[model samples]
Structures are given as C-alpha cells and as structure tokens.
Target: MSNANKHMPFPELTANEVSNLWSSFLMNSMQQRLLEYFLASTDDSKIKQIIEKILTQSQENINELKEIFDKENLNAPQGFTEKDVRIDGIKIFSDTFILNFCFDLTHLSISTYPIALSECTRNDIREHFQRNIAFTVKIQDEIVELMLSLGVYLKPPQVAIDSEVELADSFMYLNGFFGGSRPLNAAEIANLSRIIHRAQFSKMIFVTFSKLAKTKDLKQHFGKGRDGIEKVLNSLKEVLDKENIPISASGDYLISNVEASPFSDKLMLFFVNTCLGIFCFTMVNQAMTSSLRTDVVSKLGKISDDMKKFYGSGLLLAIKEKWFEQPPQAVDRKV
Candidate 1:
C-alpha cells in the first residue's frame, strides 16, 4: 500500500455502507436462528455439517457487526432471537429442501455483497463484505457438489448456438405478439429459466409458511404470495413452452404436513418481504432489461407491478403489527 493511503484516517460510513451493514446484521441474525433449527433437525451427516459451519459463520458475522455498531454508537437491530424460533418444533422441510434453501441464500449473498462492497469507502466495511462474498461462494460450491452427488441438482436447459455471428437487422426480431418474434436468445432463456426456478422455490416456501402461520392475516398474505408466484411461473413458462424448451420444477412435495409453526410470524414475514421480495424484483428487472422480445419484457413488467403491490401490502401488515424495525436515519434538525 502507498504510504499516504496507508496513513490516511478512515472515513465515516456512508449512508449506503450503513444501510448495507444494518441489513447484513439483521439477515445474518435471522439466518443464525433458522440454521440453528435446521442443524438440530437434519439427520444427514453431510447436510448437518454444512448447516453447522454456516451457523457458526453467521454467529461470527453477528459479533463482528456488533463491534462495528458499537464503534459507531449505533443501536443494533433487534432482528430475530431465540424466542422467534422453536427448536423443538417438528421438522417441516426435508433435508433436500434445507440444502436448497442454503444454496438459494448463496445466490442472494453473491448478488448483494459485491454491490455493497463497491458502495463502501471504509476499508473495514469493504473487507467485511469481501469476506462474506468469498465465504458464501465457497459454501455455494460445497452445496452444489453435495446436491450433484445426491442426484438432486436441477440443471438449466441446454441450447446449441450457431457458429456464425448474427445481428438484429430488423425490428421484426423484437416482435412477440405479432408472431414474427425471433427465437429466444441465450440471455432471455437463462433469465426465464432462473426466474422459473426461483419462483418455484418461493411458491413452496409460501405454501409451507401459510400452513404454519399463526394469524389469519398472515396466512392470507402468504396464500396471496403463493398465488402471485404461480401466476408468474405460468406466464414465464409459456414463453419457454412455445419454443419446446423443457423447464424442470423443483419438488413441492419436499415440505412436510407438520402443522406446528417453527418460526414466529414476524420472522417468516420479514424473510418473505426482504429475501424473496427483493430478490424477485432484482431478477425480474434483470430479465426485463436483458430480454429483446417485447412480449417477454411486457410480461416481466406486469409481474414486477404485481410483486410491488403484494410486497407493499406485506410491509403494511408488518407496520400494523409493529414488527417493522426502523433503520438508522439522519437526525431531524427541525425537532
């Protein structure tokens, strides 16, 4: 490192950095509680080992985040606690579902951590995100290998590309509803496949949560979420179906009929609102931008609008129940 750069004082955390750190702390805390339950319930030794490792890592991350908050004199978020999870509750998801859940989390971390890292100017915060990204990538590889060995991995559709380079020479290539639309390109196919897969997983989660939710309102909210996901899946699947591309559905049978709630309504609602809700929007936005077909873009736009309404309602429910914690904010000088 250069002498001047090394000797320079650390800057105060930017608003972006503070927001990322705050969100990370809450996410990791919730994951820790969820993982603790998973670790207690899993019978597979391999899956148990992975769960243990991740749980430990989450605890460590929480401690580190606490130190950061302490240094800044920021009040730590309440996040989730032992009271939010019932470790003695009956196992609701299969071992495979647990593994896939962890795998899905890696996708969320990989996508967000780099963006957070880029937004940070402080050396300490940058290193924190960098470390998390690396750890999540490593765990993701391990989960994939295990899934492959167990014959549970669902691969995306394979397509053969032409050897010759081609360019879009006419506006007709973008047409979809008019029936002159060009064949789905690699990017469009990928985005469609990813969205389908994610939606399937999310639908299963919604179903499981709905069955276990304590309140009538929460159950209704989850039911609506499940319906919304199915609507999106059908629309996206039709685009792939027209091309005769096969899309594999994840196992909805993985959830057990255990009626007992393992997690508090607050935790489940927060998970849906932040993890699934934010990731869904991100994926749909990416698909919209990458897709050249007008029909595909239009479909995504409609889905995005639907998700905004559904998730917005969830936020209102959280607020009404006094479950939504306020994030750090600028001081009000007028006060």
Candidate 2:
C-alpha cells in the first residue's frame, strides 16, 4: 500500500460505502476468528454446525463485497489479519460473554444497514444494501432467539403485529418518519424547511438513548455515539435552515395501530425496541450530516433529555414487568 494516507485514508465514503467496507471487513474478521475457534473445539457436532453456518454466510458476503469492489473499482482491503482475530482464542458458547459480543456486533451491522442504503448514491448499491439489511436482520433475530433459548438474558423483540399485512404497513409508516423524506430537489429542499425539526426531534431521541444505554458487559457499545450523532444532526439542521426551509421541531416515534407486545414477552420486546432505538438514532445522524443543519443539532441536544427519559422509562417498565416472573414468592426465614 502507498505510504501516502497509509491505512486510514481521508476519502469521504457515502453511508453505503462506509458500511459496505466495514461489514466486509467485519465478516472476514469474524469468519477467521470463528473458524479458528471451531477448529480448536473438541469436534462437537453442535459447535461445528454453528461454525459452518456462520462461515457460509460470511463467505457469501465476502463474495458480494468482491463483486461490489470490482464493479465500483474500489480498492478492497487485503485478507484478514491475525489482529482481526483478537477474539479467536475466545470460546463462543451459548451463554458466554463471547456470544454476547458476537451478537452485539451483528446488531451493529444490521442497525447500520438501512442508514447506509438510505445514504448511498447508486440505485444498484442501495438495492444491494437493502437486501443485505433484511438478511442481517433475520440473522440477528435468529441469533437473539438462540441466545434466549440458552438462558441468556438477551431477548428477541416482540412487536405485536395484528397480521403480517398490518405489521408491514405499520412498520413502513412508522419507520418512514425517521428514514426521512425522499431525496430533496433544490426547489423541494427550499420548501421543506419545517420538516427539519421533525428530523431533529427524531435525532434527539436517538442520541439520548445512545447515551442512556448501559455500557457494561453484554450491552451495545456505541462508542461516543451521542456526540457523533449530535454533530450530524446539527449539520443537517443548519443547512435546511440556511436554505430558508422551515426547520420544524423534532418529531416523536410515529405510533401506529399495531399493538404493543404483552408483558410476558418483555425481554424479547426490549431487544427489538433497543434495536429500533438504535436505528432511529443512526437515521438522525445520517440526515443531520446530509442536511448540514446546526440549529437542528442544537435542538436535538436540548430535547434529547426528554426523549431519553421517555424511552428509558419504557425500557425500565419492560424490565419491571419481567421481574414479575412466576409472581415472586417470599421466602420465610425462621430464626
């Protein structure tokens, strides 16, 4: 590699480019580590099955990345390195910390996929990203469910959809609020000022949740997530306002007729809700960066506390409901 700009270059990546490159790298990194771990296992059938399944998926994604790199004439990084396999020596058991780490990484990839698709320039790339996003989500849900079955506290999200049909529509409309409006024409951009606030408020909820999430073991590690998002939200808010768009205040999560899952499934519900929370946060970050709005960012920071409190309460309530498992019997201690 050329010494100029060395490993980390300053080239600006579209959201798609950034995620594609990162996911490709991560898949390669994960595959290598997983293979090593499996080889070290005592030839257990269950472990082998899990290893083969994940390795197969990684190979598929690797092939896809190669195709994208070749078509785009982008330089793909070299093969995976020893350093990439930092966790190779670690065992990934159903209830172990390594399993949590792997699942968290999967969540990161899935959460960012939609953002990248929304930000990418080319239609083909966007479509590819969208497909990958869906695949990743399915994989994530499966992984979480597996963990839950193993008695890991990590639960699958249970958004109570009436029917698949109803769920589809609810997801579309609700997600759209954060996904942002269609790409703006110059004239349309000029007229869409008020919508900026809606974006800001959405961003506010995202950043606040990012900050509030517990960072200890088995939790999502966003790494300066709040600051990074605020920067992006401010940029978008500023640009929209500069263009005389009526930068509206931040909007709320658009609730639909879709019912909330019952308290019995609180654990799984939290898993899904947390993932959605992260998605909303990322979209806000992307939109803010794309729009270059300072005012929106500022407002986002100001209002994030309220949003955090709102969502935080939801998470706590979910946990509280879980505490009712088997109706807690009081132990009688006779001295």
Candidate 3:
C-alpha cells in the first residue's frame, strides 16, 4: 500500500483528555465541605430527608469513580483548595447563596456526565453513566416542583419547531442513529462534549433552585430534569468512547461567586434556573444535528422541549408568585 494510503493510529493523550480535570478534582473535594455546610444550615424536615438521600448517592458515586480510576491505573488528582472556588460575589452566609452553590455543582455535573459517557467503549459503562444522568435529571425536576409548590415559578423558553413535522422527523432520525455504526471524528466528539457540558451547567442552576424552593413540587420537577439530562449525557459518552475520544478535565467550567446568589424563595430560584436552562438548550439545539447522529439529534430535540416546559412552568409560577415583571413570549408546544 502507498504510504499515504496507510491508516494512521489515533492520537494518544498522556495527560487526562480535558484541561479542567484538575478543576473538577478540586471542585469535588470542595463538595464535601459544601455538604457539611448544608447539613448545618437547614432545619426543615422534608428538605433534610432529601438532602440525606442525595448525600448517600453522592458518596457512592465518588467511591465508584475512585474504583474506576484504580482499575485503569489512573491517578486521581488532588483538587483545588476552597480558596480556589471561594467567591466574594455571592454572599455565602445567605440561604439563597447556599442554594445557588448547590445548583452550580449539580448543573456542572449534568454537563460532565455526558462527556465522560461519550468516552466509554463498553455498554455496561454507558448504561451506568446513563443512570447517573437520569438521577441528576430526577433531582432537578424535583427541585422545580418544590419551588412551584412554594409559589416560585421559572419561565420556560420559546422553542420554534413544527410540532407534527418535528415529531415525525425526530423519531425517524432516531432510528437511523441507532441502526448505524455510531459516527466518530475529532470534531464530532468535541461537539458532543460541548452539548453535555451545556446541559450540566443548566442542571447546576436547577440544583440551586432546589435548595431554595419551599415546596415539594418544584424540587421534584428539577430532579426529574436532572434524570433526563443524565440519560442524554450517558448516551453521548457511549458513542464518543466507541469512537475513541473521551472528554476529560479540559472541558469543565470555572465557577466563582459571580454566578452564585441566594434565592429568597422558590420563585427567585426558578427564575435563575430558567435562564440557565434556556442558555443550555440553545447550545444543545445548535450542536445536535440530523447529519452526524440522527438518533442523538432527535433525542436532544425532544429533551430541549422538555427543558423548555420546565422553564415555562417556572415562569408561570413566578407570575403567580407576583414575581413576573412581564412574561416573555409563550413557548412552542410539542405533542
């Protein structure tokens, strides 16, 4: 064979794939401290029960990650000091601030889960990560529902899709993606990672709302959203890993107090989260295409509407809370 015709080997990364690995390691370290702070601050019984349940889940995930690293001969990096994440912008002492902090972390998780899933080659690993994504979505939906029950509403986004056409096209495209050899290229892998990251940040906003929401319904809505995003992230990860491009530390976000703020009540929290979800949905919508992975695109489009509804519900609740200055244009409804 001609030298030019010879197949080239995939590029090997000596360090972890993403640059933000160190940041993530550090952030996870800080989560323990944050959890401790939350345990001491809230006295509400229902909220306490939910917190405990989540804490257990978080602990298990950490252990599982550590085991994965050990089996792979990978060394986990020591994370950043609290000072690295500490921001003066959001007053840490306020209830709203604490809630916002949790939201940020959860949102980030939503983003990272898919990227990691994209890198895995095995079905078992993909399924495991997908479950994690679902858990996150469930948590986010719960948070939103809880906020709504408390009279806090987050406004949903205005999505523009021909309902009938989109529904039919989406399902048809999804079949194509599942039937084919999942496409893999450096650009495609990067795009998938971007979609996951966008979703994660969006979820962080919902987590923040959960902390501040007064009722069970808003909280439930946010939690459910987390579950859905988690599944998408997991699927993305599976495809990416099969293609041999796993996202690592390089793709994470840098959170400071600027993005942190206390929600005075469920309404305030929903308002913030709605904005975050819209931003994320836009990115997901843009990155998702019928060309590369039709199944993924269709799935993403459906989820985009799901999130939009969450945002819309939050907005309506905000109006009920007497919190709406003026409602944005009504969002497109999907069947």
lDDT of each: 0.90, 0.45, 0.52
Candidate 3 per-residue lDDT over residues 298-322, each given as its tens digit? 6667767776776777676656665
- Report the number of the highest-TM-score candidate: 1
In terms of lDDT, model 3 sits at: 0.52
Return the TM-score for each candidate structure: 0.96, 0.38, 0.41
In candidate 3, what residue range of length 10 has the lowest lDDT sum?
249-258
Tens digits of per-residue lDDT for model 1 on 175-232? 8888667889899999999999999899999998999899999999999999999999
Give candidate 3's total backbone clashes: 76
Q: Which residue pairs collide, candidate 1?
A: none
- TM match of model 1 to true structure: 0.96
Top model number, lDDT: 1
Encode model 2's per-residue lDDT on 9-50: one tens digit a residue.
334445546555655554454455545444453244543445
Worst 10 residues of 2 by lDDT: 255-264
